[model samples]
Target chain A: MATIQHPYLLFLGDAPDQLAAKTANGVKVWRPEWCIGQFRLPGCKADLGLPDVSIEEAAAQGAKTVILGVANRGGFIPESWIVELVKALGLGMDIASGLHTKITAIPSLKDAAERNGRKLFDVRHPSRDYPVASGKPRPGKRLLTVGTDVSVGKMFTTLAIEKEMRARGLNADFRATGQTGIFIAGEGASIDAVIADFISGCVETLAPANSEDHWDLIEGQGSLYNVSYSGVTLGLIHGAQADALVMCHEIGRPHMRGLPDYPVPEIPTAMDTILHMAKMVNEDVKFVGVSLNTSNVSADEAAAFKAKTAEQTGLPVVDPLKDGVAPIVDRLLAG
Target chain B: MATIQHPYLLFLGDAPDQLAAKTANGVKVWRPEWCIGQFRLPGCKADLGLPDVSIEEAAAQGAKTVILGVANRGGFIPESWIVELVKALGLGMDIASGLHTKITAIPSLKDAAERNGRKLFDVRHPSRDYPVASGKPRPGKRLLTVGTDVSVGKMFTTLAIEKEMRARGLNADFRATGQTGIFIAGEGASIDAVIADFISGCVETLAPANSEDHWDLIEGQGSLYNVSYSGVTLGLIHGAQADALVMCHEIGRPHMRGLPDYPVPEIPTAMDTILHMAKMVNEDVKFVGVSLNTSNVSADEAAAFKAKTAEQTGLPVVDPLKDGVAPIVDRLLAG
Candidate 1:
């Protein structure tokens, strides 16, 4: 995957304030040069501290592309955002959105992009039909970071693992499965947005079959314990047919995000379930390690969390950001 | 679900001889009038004695419906079945198929059925758009038999449970999710055949809102441990919003039915995974009992297996067919 060389404007359209992290994540990771003034629903807190500028203002600042950075439920771009989008297109910025509801599906947006002779990137639409999983062994070694819950650092862990692997002189690539990863990498399918039946097939297409010395670090989605999206997770697991797995977890979460009644599952139980499920399709699948997310904890707390999780699961555990993913990378290489 | 009063001819259609059990299952359970001759692939055994006849002969025997009864890999109906299908339609018989490839998709077969004014029953097509799962409390209680692997008596156990419940004077209905159960019950969506995204939605529609005393005994599908089909299993669990569960395990099965390397997961782990996953969606879900499939085991072995499984899981275990589902029914009622 190559980086996008064109300067782009990040657009967070009428998103609820609670989604600031998601919006900020795109900016921080993708490092878009200029961001349009924040757009938010009423009562949303806008505290990210980026310079507030309108779409025209950002375009004047040399933004050649507009990337929708905030997530909306059902991925529907708001009606209000269309006007600003048109103005941006009129200002000569190409539009790229990862929403399930494609920007191309909106006639006005489609026409504006076409009239301007600019590309409209819809990352969710799969380019072609993918073959159903044959349960055959692929040529390359694949590593997937599955999580105990959504937003528990699967993507971050995957990226970190890939970085460490490459540093150690291994051929490694990060296979993106979500919007943030796609924005940073400049190519990938939003597996969740793909039609459910074809998700596994799409994942299969994402990670090209390669030789054994090559490593594909695949990002994951919803947990097996997450009912609303377990299908996506299962599909990714079976589709990638990974040789090794890294379980991801966040510290101090009492329940699944947005699911108050459902407590976060025990890490060991989650790990075992993933290992058994993966091995069911790929007989040689193994649980190589764990990746801990200690974003909100102190250094001492993070260390204790890592040690405890490692002891409990009997797998090396590390915070990718704090401790680096070298231990997990070593485990993957050994396997 | 109501009974199909029409006399249907079971079409085994060039399937290998080992699939006789699948054909015989439909006949024994659905009990269509006067058995028709078996069809076989060349060099295949035809030891299941029934009237050996062609499709035309079956139509002559007053068969008004042609039910494609044998299971095929990849759910593709063999090309050789087209000729017999054309002949059957010419005889004014309606065609019904449970295979993933809809019979209606075959232009010739569809034209024949339509021209003859006969209905084409594509049993796997979802009857209607089912609503996304709201995770709200459903009206009636539901009992779903989950399994450690596919073909482990989920449907039979569900039927047995409903039977025992009804005999004890409780309101009960069997919710079928596969072909054989659908044939017996006269109405059901094949949950496995539905597109992955809407599987949970279809299951939600199968067992509708009802009064408090009502009980919907939902038949299960592929196991959560079965990698090839875990999405279907997970979707069904969440969609059913079941209040109680029966863990089903087959005695003497060393591995998953089709995937050889995928060993049948240990019953306790499978039970816990199902419980945890279900509880994540439906907080009230409970593991009520165990259903053991002892068809291939000796009487003594079956008894010992039942006892050991019951002791291991700390739940009452019974062979629903031989010993009756009374114990499981009692637990469901108590819950």
Candidate 2:
């Protein structure tokens, strides 16, 4: 993994809407101290509520990296964005991007970084090799947020838990495993880009041995029932050796993502399958709670659903955004 | 995948023993008509029992490619071997290798191949991009050989089944998913070498829609209980959309491969877990038979073990090498 330097100058390059700059919003919300200010191109529709800073002003303010925080269609780095990136590199700042198109692959950005002696970080692609996972139990504790399907708020749930743990002065760190999470963390591998043989190994490396008192809140991917991505999910489960797992689910998903014929697994079935696989590496693995994405439901519906789920599973349930992860964190601490 | 031209000259370059040239032995055993002759340098300790021919003689004998068929220490193509590879390229023959060190990375062989307008295939690396698996059922009858552990004869069992099915005038093709299997089949991707997200997708492409009666005997990889590689195994299961599955297990395994503390999963437990995961994609998936590697046991022990296993699982059980997979094929075709 690359040591992406901060304070970051987030670049919202002509984003079509606020949703296009969600990555920027995540960074601002999670690591506000590391953010210097936002830099926007002409016709940009997103704002980070920070003062607009130019390349020169950001450099003067000691920004060490210019982050490409907005996603456009196709995840491409537009030709116009390259000019701003090149200028940032020339002004003694590294560049970090989570786009499908690598900033380092642009010749102008590449040459400028080389001449200026700065780095270019493509957070989506791993920057180092990983060994085959040994599946040995390492020190410290881990809690993984697995899901019923993709895009079910696993990352958000994980980050919320990390925040709650920190508020209580618990020793915990959020371990990122995806592109946006990688950018937010400033340094972590995107596990999906790794070779199939090394998926678990990459996760093992991402959350290595630490103090026995500490917790690594590992962000999860895919799902045990998702035919398209269950491999990634299983690898993460094995490598995490998670002592506790938090199941994430959306209230109204019709089917597994991208596979219309496959229905989302029932919660109990999903829990049984995931726990069975996780126990191969950690025999003591247990489910601490459930996190729901109840955005589609009204407040009354969300509360009713959460209560019913809690009663059914005998575990605390909450919408991480609406209710926070306090109930889940309380269960984790109790254990 | 690379269309590796055959009529191959097998290069057994200074291998220490016959086991080192097992890949060459496999190709000769499975695709004898495609092998021209064996090529050995001085000090070679292994022989494929074919006529020893020089590059010029092999090319004259209609060899389209020179296959590096021995595993040396570190899987590196030795400096001495490159000279012969370049010579073969000049003689209108392409080069194919399954070494950890890629032949195309060697400047001399790469330059030679480019100048001669020939191809250099690194079979251990995927040659093309793959889409994520859709998990939709395609038109084909597929049989997948899953395993109890890594190196438990999944590939051999699959090949044996293909041979038996072909001999019976049944429509079947062996779908390779590893380096040795790739060379035997002439064209297929090494599934473990693929990007994590594309593991199932690569398998989907390798064994695509065919005539409804045709069978693609897709070779499997690591075990579902093997913590290090269950991800690859799960991905393969989902992508196979297999109508029939053959479980391959080695007799008398004390523990899971590479993990001292993890015991090998019992056959019934393994079957239940694998079938549960497989059902996520193909609800009708069934275990047609079990293939055992009985080489470690005496003849009496092998027979008793096979009979016991058959009774335990209610499926045909056979040592793919000794028993010839006839019973398993009968079971498969009967359905």
Candidate 3:
């Protein structure tokens, strides 16, 4: 790699929240900012205020480079985003799996990114679809799922949290298969059918996503689709599609009580909650990551929560801004 | 494994279209009739129509589940709709990811869903502040940001497209992260920021979803979220986001001969368009998976385009929906 220079790195993405944390030589830096975007399905009457962004815009911001972060959940951010990322960011965009949109966008984006001084990075280590090549699924292995809640910034903080652990060195990964909750269909699809469908759907996704030493980091944002910025995907209810199980709390309320007394919820503590969920998803939770939302909690509180989590979970907690993420990535990578 | 009755499986969501074939055995269905309620983002001028329900609803509805479907886009959808889903659909009610409305509603929702034999499926993933275990970053091996636009059904149909391949044994887990489109968010953070903020301020929304899977057979009457349907989410954008992506022919008068009808610019043959983008992104384009809008092109045309791609790149040209998503995921997972 021609000895890449410039220690400080900021991953600008349409999903700024997902790209939180400033990094330098494997250490954390200034407040990590995550990009949060809200969108609505065309022709639909609702507006889902979620966290996401285009790879192009992410790169366009002119950072050393930008990372295309995907939800560990089996889905995509539109082929257009990937295509844009290739021409915008360097170090490339990382795809969770080459299933739906990524399959189409990444490849196209690979070529685009190459020309733009960037490239596409595949994050799906052992795809479930490639059975012969994939190793068996093992809990507490390399990959894991760290569930999260609403609040784009929190999600970003959580998603970008690998730096701290990496700074120390650990074997872990988060399975971010977008929020997993109840899904519904107007038709008469039964619950068992729904559960089975949910299971199978997720299996189909994470199965191909199967990998060794890999863990999951799922998010259970309150109130899935149809509701404001809270709810699960429609796919969850139809097929058995939850491989990265997540547990979240509803924070998308207005003037809610017990909060830090701000528009945003208390993030640091919220992260502590997800750490517990990480254990439930995988008992031996090797390492932990958190997603903080400044809008919700104070930076100090977020930092304090980090220490508390380390004390409670007995697992190293990472804050992308304070700790570089490369070290954490190394720990998660197979030797 | 104790012959696990339900397996309590988890799906890595992806495309709903391709999942139709994949979900036959284990289905993941979304209410094709649902809609998000978004007027405009707190900063941006776009909308996001997300889903609203819980994991409990999926279990009850009997959706086998597949990859990320649309509906989850959080932009607009009356908050009351969520109440209806919780009250009527039971497991059908879910929450979007952005904003604070739903996150704050969790405590009360537990009662509503539990009383109806459903679970809220909370959101609690790791944050950027997650403490490190083994003193390492433990960055997950991958990241995915999945979503869609054009409404819930289109998002569902477009996102679920991995099915045709899954039936062939491709594991394309879908995860719906709602929607995040360019045309949706303007370049300026001022307006965009406001829209984004307003979106964050939102929560506890309602979007009644309806899926378009093979079993559900939602053919003629499309979703209430589609342009065909009388949805305001699309109107909110004033044809900016979607229109920007559109290509047209310089035919005549105030509007020329439109496009879709005469097929002048012809939406640029998939191969030609991809190749153009490929050159812009990278030069060494090899494998590619094309999911053509069958609704727009004919079998012969699609075949011809695929043939052209193969001839031009000398790499594998796979049809995402038909070929399944396994090969693509396999390549990304290569050691």
Task: Estimate the TM-score of every prediction.
Answer: 0.69, 0.98, 0.25
TM-score, A chain, model 3: 0.34
lDDT (Cα, tens digit) per residue for candidate 1, span A106-220: 9999898888876677765554455554455669888888999899999888887876887788899888888778766667777765554455667778887898799888999
Compared with the true structure, what per-residue lDDT tens digits does model 2 show for residues B1-335? 66889899999988888998999998999889999899888888898899899999998999998888679777677788888888999999988898777888889988999999999999988878999998888998999989889999999999999989999898999999998999999899989989999888988999999998999999999998898998999999989999999999999888998998899888888999899888887888899999999888899999998888889999999888877899999888888
Q: Please report the candidate that would top DockQ against the real structure.
A: 2
lDDT of 1 by residue, B187-303 (tens): 787776565546666777888899999999899987777666667788888878889999998989987866666678888988877887787667778988998889898999988
Interface RMSD for each of the candidates: 3.1, 0.7, 19.0
The candidate 2 chain B region of ten consecutive residues with least summed lDDT is: B69-78
Model 2, residue B335: C-alpha shift (Å): 1.5
lDDT of 3 at A90: 49
lDDT of 1 at A287: 83
How does candidate 2 fare on TM-score? 0.98
**How accurate locally is residue B192 in candidate 1, as Cα lDDT from 0 to 100?**
60
**Which regions in candidate 3 have their CA more than 4 angstroms from the true location?**
A1-138, A141-149, A152-154, A176-214, A218-252, A255-335, B1-335
Candidate 1: global Cα-lDDT? 0.75
True contacts kept of each: 0.23, 0.75, 0.02
